[model samples]
Target: MPDLHSIPYLVGAGIVLLHVIGILHVIHAIMTVRTSQGTIAWMVSLIAAPWIAVPIYWVAGRSRFSGYVRARRSDDAELLKLSDDMHRRLREYEIKPDDAFGRAAQFLGGLPFTRGNELTLLIDGEETFESIFKAIHAAEKYLLVNFFIVKNDRIGTRFKDALIARAKAGVQVYFLFDEIGSHRLSRSYLNEMKEAGIHCSHFGANRHWWSRLQINFRNHRKIVVADGKEGFIGGLNVGDEYLGRDQRFGAWRDTHLKLKGPSVQAIQLVFIEDWNWATDEVPDLEWTGQEHTADQVAAIIPTGPADPADSWQLVVAEAANSAQERLWIASPYFVPDGGVLTALQAAAIRGADVRILIPEKADHLLVWLSAFTYYEQTIPFGVKLYRFKKGFLHQKVILVDNKLACVSTANLDNRSFRLNFEISGLTPDPVFVGEVAEMLENDFGNSEPVKVSDFTARAFWFRLACRVARLMAPVQ
Candidate 1:
């Protein structure tokens, strides 16, 4: 018999047990239906004692498509035109010499690759903010904004003010921010936006601890489209750190793209899908689209929790598998799950020039340790590694065959690949790819190579620490 004081705790445990049992039933049903290579013993245990299996699955299992749910039919018709425009860019590689990369860049991003999108890269965060704001101020009709981290800081306030002004001026603005990623924002900010007439909503931020099943699912997409003619994407977030004002990290090194073309429509569609998910509202379709160009301009690789197709991860896998000449990856967090790690090892084994870039200092101690331990195996495959001592090198850019690149908010880690909703754009334009390649080579120039000896020098406990963290990758 439990004491009266222990009732709540016991009840909580019992509820968790109940759910675990339910999940086991779900898993058993799924395994039986699919005839998976999944362990029969595990399935039996899951059915017999779900509590144990639920924890293991969360930490180590790959979630099947049947296990997750996607957006409903109400996910706005307004996205159709924008999606069509974006799809066209993805299929057609039409543009000037300024846009084309190497010969492979012409065909690498997939079928119908085109190179005609006019693009401008903004280096300064403050300048990027001002440029985007100016475009917003000048907008005549629509504005779509998406961000992974949208805080209520100085920039957020300014952005909010701008959106309110635009709303007053009658521009239809749809703002989408991830619930968990931007969890720091107060209710007041949202209330203020609604009051000011701006349409704002949050992506999956299920805080209910009882069943926050997909809290790992985050919208790591940072995009903006104005009047369906202009678009922007890249790593710039609305914060002082982005402006290089932080005393800790010296200069903020990041990239954001300014697009003047039909590609903007596709990015806009990405926003609409998320907006509809949050608000359950259908938007008007067939509005006048602003044409920015005819030359093949840009392409988008949309990623998220709602995608039933799991396209982004496949693209990454394909890029890794397709690397014949060389592969250069610059990511702040270099923890790739077993699948990606296997791909890197295989690519290196096949004699592809494989190199990875990570940050020098630890952002998250556990994640860093797990990655460092994994390095012991990677170096053996001739997979070179580097640490950008310049700052927190939080970049997720990949250059394959010295031509094509997948740049986005998605990190190479398992969290970004399978759990988070991330977006990246594909560029086949030789000019853009050339500039990007040069930038990567330059990064390798200044960064220090993380040698194998570095791992051996770590204290025994530190190495042990990473081994433990690795066990948690499945849940992450």
Candidate 2:
């Protein structure tokens, strides 16, 4: 098998490439790094087979993005410190489900599901803006605004301008955005905020190829809180498309919320943690005590790789299991995890009305393909699925018993469950929950359901390719 004939020429080419790399290294020291003998041993593994070795490093190497990684893992320490306390609060109550997804109620959303929380579902984008701005206008101590996509466009400009204004007004504002997801925003926009005294940080930015594991970890949550008084959460973001202004997406359908209660404090905590991670700026722990409104709040749930509460995943499972009359699901990306898919199928098999509505054409094709491959298993379990024929459906919501549900930033993929930091609000309030469920039903009615046999009988190779792609899918 040895082809000695061309070995000399191939060797010559490798030598040329190495020379170019050496020259570049001399120019900028981009790849050159300080090292010790032990460090040199670790470095050798990277050069031996970079492509394969790089990925392994990513899965196991140290993260240079996490500011505290060099110090100590604070998330772990805080989690352990409060583990016993969190356990007691968790054991306080059991979830109640008559016919919907929470029938078995494994999550135990505490004893008082809707007891002290004052949850409000905001139906108007304009109203959400006004509410958030009003809270920002009323900021006394600190303001935390985090978003995945913060463009320099119309809505984004306004939000940024307000934050800048608040910072100038002596309000402490921390802004956290994803590096890759929000890459479209120009340096000028960020500079303007910095000039105005706003403390900003980008989640997981530049790193060497060998040290860039979990680089895909994103910050997908959309939240805005002012002095922990008023909190805004849900699917809406700072984009005209979110406000139904996109010419292509006529009459955009989306959902957002303004939560006022003790839960808002929890939302603020996540922002502070992100701020600490990105900028190494320790936020005031007592900042949580300052509330704009002393309203009763619900879960105040946030989840990600750094936190292993699994509150988001468990919430989804409970919602699916508690499905009563119907379970309506709508998400831009519908690639569910094992526990989520199981609970959904089980609910349908148990005779709960289950309908899943996803977009026919989304911005991400791999996600769509993976979701489509599960039609056979899901449909056979009595799960009715619909595909939106219009534009992308970026909203993530679940309706169970038309009484309890959630609107979340978390996707069904593993990235959302275990990697990316995300936020979601789960509520048992019938009015808002009913609205969320009914809205999903309207979306389902606007689209066509997937024929079970037809989907199962697709071309073998197409299905096979999709199955293969599924292996590469994001995981928790």
* Candidate with best TM-score: 1
Output the worst ten-in-a-row residue range by lDDT, candidate 2: 29-38
Query: Which candidate tops lDDT?
Result: 1
lDDT of 2: 0.66
lDDT of 2 by residue, 1-476 (tens): 54899898888887666555434433322232221332343355555544444444446332123433442355556533433333344333323334433432223322223234466776546777777888888898878888888888898899899899989998888888887678898999999999998888886533345434555566788889877657788877788877767776655556777776545655665676666566656555333232233233245456664542445566677778766677777777777767889999999988898888877765666777788777877988898888887555777777767566777787777566555777877676676766676677677767888887655688988787678667556431
lDDT tens digits by residue: candidate 1, 413-447: 66766667666666665677787788788778878
lDDT value for model 1: 0.68
What does the lDDT read for residue 22 in candidate 2?
39
